[model samples]
Target chain A: MNLTGWKERLFQRYLIWSCRREKIRRYLRDSLPSLPLPDPVDRRSVRVGALQVKLELCKSPIAFADLVHRRVKEAYEAGARLVVFPEYLNLLLFGMLPGIEELEKDYSTGIAAIAKNEQQEQTDVISLPDLFRFMTPAVQPLIFTTFSALAASYHLYIMAGSYTIADQGAIVNRAYLYDPKGELIGYQDKIHLLPVEEEWKIKRGKIFNVFESALGRLAMPVCMDATYFETFRILEERGAEIVMLPIANLEAYNYWLALRGIWPRVQESLLFGVKSALVGSIAGLTFTGRAGIFAPLELTSNRDGVLAEVDCFDNEALAIADLNLDSLHELRCSHPWRDHNPALYRRYFPQVYKR
Target chain B: MLVAALSLAGVDLSSINGYISGLINLLTAQKPVVAVLPAHSALALGLGVGRLNSSNTFQEASAYYFAEGTEWTSEFLNLHGLLAKELQIYLVTGNVIEKDEDLSYQTCYCLNPAGQVCCAQRQTHLTRFEQDLHLSRGDKLDLFRVGNFYTGLVIGNDARHPEVGRIMALQGADLLLHSGAIEGDQTCWQQAAGMWAQVQQNQLYAVEAQLSATIANTVFGGNPSIIAPCETTFGNTGYLARCNPGEPLLCAELDKETLSEIRNDNPLLKLLNFDAYTEICGSEPQ
Candidate 1:
C-alpha cells in the first residue's frame, strides 16, 4: 500500500479511538465525583458567571488558551461555581494558524452571501470543517487538556461554549460541560445551525439533553437555540433548572434580538438563564453585547429580571450573580403553571403550531 | 388617545352617584378617549364592599349576593352603561363579582364608544383568596376593537401568565389593558417590570391600572404605568406614559401605524417556530 493511503487509514482509526476515549473519560469523571452532595443536598443556591470577550486574531492557540484561563481565574475568584464562555471560541484557535488572514478575509463575504440567501458556492475563507481538519490532533488534545485542567484546578463547572471539531467525518459545533474535578460530564451540540454554518457543512444536532450535577439539572443551548422557545419548554419539562446560553452576535440588532429571546424563556420556564457573548471586533465585524445573568424579573429588587450584568458593550466583562433555588421553588406556586387551562390553549397546537 | 389612571384612597359607597359623576367630569375635562379605573373599584362602590379588613367593615362582601346588593349593582351597571356610551369613549374595567345563576366569576366589562357593553372578560387565573371565595375561573379570552386597533383585557393575577398577553398579541391586539388588585405592597415594581417585559416580548403596548388603597390594615401598592415596545414612534423609550405614586391619571397617544411598522420590521410574531412550539411547549411532561 502507498504511504499516503496508509496515513489516511491511520488517521481515520485515530479519530474513532480518540472519540471513544473521550466518551469513557466523561463516564469515568462522572463516577468519580470529587464533591458529591449528601442525599438531602444542603446547598440550593449557586453562583453563576458569564465571561464576555472581544475575540481578535490571536498570535497562537496557546496564547488564546492563556487568555481564556485568565478570565476563568477571574470568574473563580469572583465566587462563581459555574462559568460560561461564548460561541465559536475556537475561532481564536483558527486566528493563530498560518494563512489565517486569508480565511478571515472571506468571513464577511461568506456571511453576506448567506445573508442574501445565495446558493452555497466556493467560500473564500476556510470552512469550519476544513479548519477543524487542519487542526493537528496533538494540538486539539492540548487545548482540551488545558480546559480540563483549568476546571479541575478551580473545582468549578465550565460550559466551554462551542468549539468546532471533526466528528464521524462531519464537523459540529459542540459545547463541553466540565465538572468541578475537571471531568467531562457531558456536551451538547448546536441544534439550529445558521446559514453561514451550513455553508461550512456544520452538522446540526438532533436531540437536546440536560446534565445533572451537584448544582442542578442544567441545559446548554448554543446561540440560536434560544430563539426556539419550545426548546426551553422541553428543557423545563425535563426538569432543567438552569440554561447556560453561549452566543456570538456581531450586529447590535442581533444582540438585542438574542436578549429578547433569552429574557422571556426564563420567565416561561421558571428558571435561571445566563448569557455569555462574544464581544468586540473579529474579522472587521464588531460583537455588540455584554454577558448577563437573568432570573424571573419578579426575583429582582429592581423588577427588571436582571440579577447582574456587564453594563458596557463590546468589552471584556465577567458577570456573576447568586441564585436561590429555594425562593425560585416558592415562586412556582404563584406562576400559574399548575392551574393553566391546557384545553383552551390546545387550538394553538393544531392550527398555529403543528408538529 | 388620552387615558386616565386613577389612584383613589377609598371607594365611598354612600355617595355612589356623586363619585361616578366626579369620574365623568374628570374624563370630560381631561378629554381622554379611554379611562382606566382600578381593578374591582366599581364592585366596591356598587356592593358597599369596603376595603377588606380582618374585622367586619361597612358590610360583608357576600352582601352583594343579597337582593338589596344585587339591585344596587344592577343600577350601577345600568347607569355606567348609558354614561360610557354617551361619553363616546372606549372604557375597560373589570373584577366585578358577577353572581349569575349558580356560578360566580369576577368579570371585566368593556364598553364601546357607543356606550354599549361589547365584551365581558372573566378572570382566568385565581389567587388563593379568590379560590377560597369560590370565584369561577374564566373559560375564554375576548378582544375588543377600538376603531382600527384591538385591545385585550387582563384582570387581577391574570397578567402574571405571559401566555395571556401573547395569545392576545397573536390575535392582532395592539394594546393590552391590565386591571388588578395586588395586596403585596412590594409587588408594584415587579408588576411594572413584568409589564415592561411583555411589551418588548410581544412588540405591543400595555397599560397597568392597579388598586391603591389602605385595605386589611395594609396600604396596597399601586404603579399605574404604560409600556410600549422600543419600536414605537417615540423610538426606544418603552413607556409612552407613567403615573406618579397614587396619581389619578395616565394619558398617552398610541401611534397604531408605528406599532404595525415595528411589528413588520421585526416580525417576531410571524416568524415563530410553530412546529417546535407545538411539539415541546404543548406536550405534557413525561
Candidate 2:
C-alpha cells in the first residue's frame, strides 16, 4: 500500500474518536420520533453538494488540506451527504511549498531557454509532468492524508478534485473518492487531456471507473471525459445513476465554455451530475465558472432538472440540493436508449465518422 | 437568412385552401435563403378529443393523419417554386401513415429547395402511442447537404436518443433539423425531452420545426425553435427563438459562424473514446 492509504486508516481512527461530539449532536436530532425517515429505496433522494473555489495559492500542503476541510464541513452543516470539490486542488500544494516562487521563476526561465534551444539540440521536451516529479515526493502523501481524515471526520463522502501524481514513469491526473468511513474507496484518472495538457506531457488515463456507494452506483468522469458519449455508455452499462464531474477551465474563463456538454451527457445517460468547478486565476490561467447540479435539459427545462448551483463566480461558494433517485427510476422507459437495439447499433462503431 | 418554423393549426380538409394563400404570402415575403415548416403541418388527425387514462387519471388521443399533396402540398409548392431560384425553403411535409408493398410506417419527407425530395425517414423508434397506432419503424438515419450546411434529419421521437445525434456529429454534420409533432396538452412528461435534448447532447446547432396546430380535439405543440451550442452563448444558452402555442412563426438566423467558433474553442470530437467506442462491435459502419 502507498503512504496515503497506510496513513489513512490511522488518521481515520483518530478522527472518529475526536468527532464524538458531532456524533452526539446527530444522535440528539435522530432521537426525536416526530421526524420520520425520508422515504426508502427507490423513493428516496440524496442531497448532494458542490464547492466552487477560486482557491488561493497555498503556503503549505497541510494548509491546503485545512482549507479544503473547512469547505467540506460547511457542506455537511448545510445538510449535504456527499460533497465534491473543484479540479487541480493539488495546484495549491506547489503554491504552499517554501521557495516555490523562486522555483516557478527558474522554471519559467528554463522553459524559455529550452524553447530557444529547440532547433539547436535534440533532447526531451520540458513538460509540466516533469515539473510534477520534483514536488511528488514531499507533498503527495499529505494531500491524501488530509482528504481521508476530513472524510472520516465529517462523515460525508468526498470526491476530492484531481491532482497530478507520479505513476510508473509518467504523471497522471487522478481523482480520489473517500467514503464516509474514510477508507480510500477508489480513484478515476482523467481520460482526455486538453491541448495544453498534451504539451505538459501529462499521460492520459485509459479506463472508465464506477464504484458502489451506499446511496447508489456512482461514477466520476473528470471534465473532458463527459465530452465523449462513449464514457457515458460505459457508465450506463455499469448501471451508474449518479455521475460527478470535477472540471477546471483556464484562460478561456467563459462559464458556458466550461459547461458546454453537461446536459447532453446526463440526459442521454439518465444520470444526475453534480459539477464542481475551480473558479479563479492561477499560474497565468484564469478559471471562471459557477458549479451546477443537473439532469438532462439542465438550464433549459422549466424545473431545470436539478436543485441548486453556485450563486456567483471568482469566489468560494456552495449549494446543496436533493436529487430524486425516484425520478431517474421512473424515467427508464421514456429515455431514448430504451428504443435502441445495441446489437444493431454496434455496426456503426468501427466506421470513422470523423477523425 | 430567415428560417421560418411555422404553425399549422386546425389544418383539415375545410381550411386546406386558405393554407395555400398563407403559404404563398410567406414564400413571397422578403425571400429567405432557406425556410422550414414543421412535420405534420399538412393535415390533422382527430386525436385531441379522445384520451385513455386510468381511474385517478385517464388519457386518449387521435391517431389519424392525412397524406400531403392531396391539395395543400401541391399548392404550397407551386407558390414556393416562384422563389425557388433565390430562396430554398425546406418543406418538411406533415407526418403521414404510409404503406409500401410489404410494410407500413409513419414517415416524413425532407425536400430540397426546388421542392424535390432529398431523403425520406420513418420513425426508427416508436413511442408507446405510436406503437399502439401500429406504426412501422425506419432503419436508417441519414444526413443531407442544405445550402452551405451539412445537415442531418431526425423526427420528433428520435431526438431522445443520443447515439442518433452522435452519429450525425461524427459524420460531420454542422446542423440538425428536428421535425416532429409533440402533444400540446403536455403538462408532465413532455417537459424534458425534445429538440433541445438533441442539440445539447450533440454539442452542435439545430433548427427545430414542431407541429403547431390543433387538429380535432388534439393540441399539437407550436414551440418551433433555433438553438446554438451553450458554449458560444456563454451559459446564456437556450433557444435563440422559441414560439408559444398561439404564435405563427419561430424565425431566426442560423449562425454557422458562432457554431464553428464554439466547436473550435471546445473540440469535443478529439476527446472521444474511439478505441472503446469502436471496440463495442468489431464491424465497420455499413
How far residue B177's Cα lies from its native spot in candidate 2, in Å, is 1.4
Which residue pairs collide in model 1, if any?
Answer: A297-A305, B5-B250, B85-B115
DockQ of 1: 0.22
Write candidate 1's Cα lDDT for B1-286 as tens digits: 5665655544344476666776677677777677666785665555344332222432244333332345555665666777788777767764566777887887778777777778888887676656666777775777887666688888877776566676777777888888866665666445643566567767888777777765424456776777787656254556677677666666777778888788777666654545345444345445
Categorize the docking of model 1.
incorrect
Q: For residues A185-289, what per-residue lDDT tens digits would candidate 2 score against the true structure?
A: 999888877766655667788778889888788788888777666677678777788888888766455544444545556766677888898887644456777
Weakest ten-residue segment in model 2 chain A by summed lDDT:
A31-40
Flag regions of model 2 displaced more than 4 Å.
A1-43, A99-127, A251-259, A296-302, A333-338, A353-355, B9-14, B43-62, B66-88, B184-204, B216-218, B230-245, B252-265, B278-286
Q: Can you write out model 2's per-residue Cα lDDT over B182-211, one digit (the tens) per residue?
A: 665452223234556556556677777777
Cα lDDT listed for each candidate: 0.68, 0.63
TM-score of each: 0.79, 0.79
Chain A TM-score of prediction number 2: 0.79
> For residues A89-176, what per-residue lDDT tens digits would candidate 1 score against the true structure?
7776655455557656765657565444354556634344554655545345645666686788678889988877877787888888
Which candidate has the highest lDDT of all? 1
| Index of the highest-DockQ prediction | 1
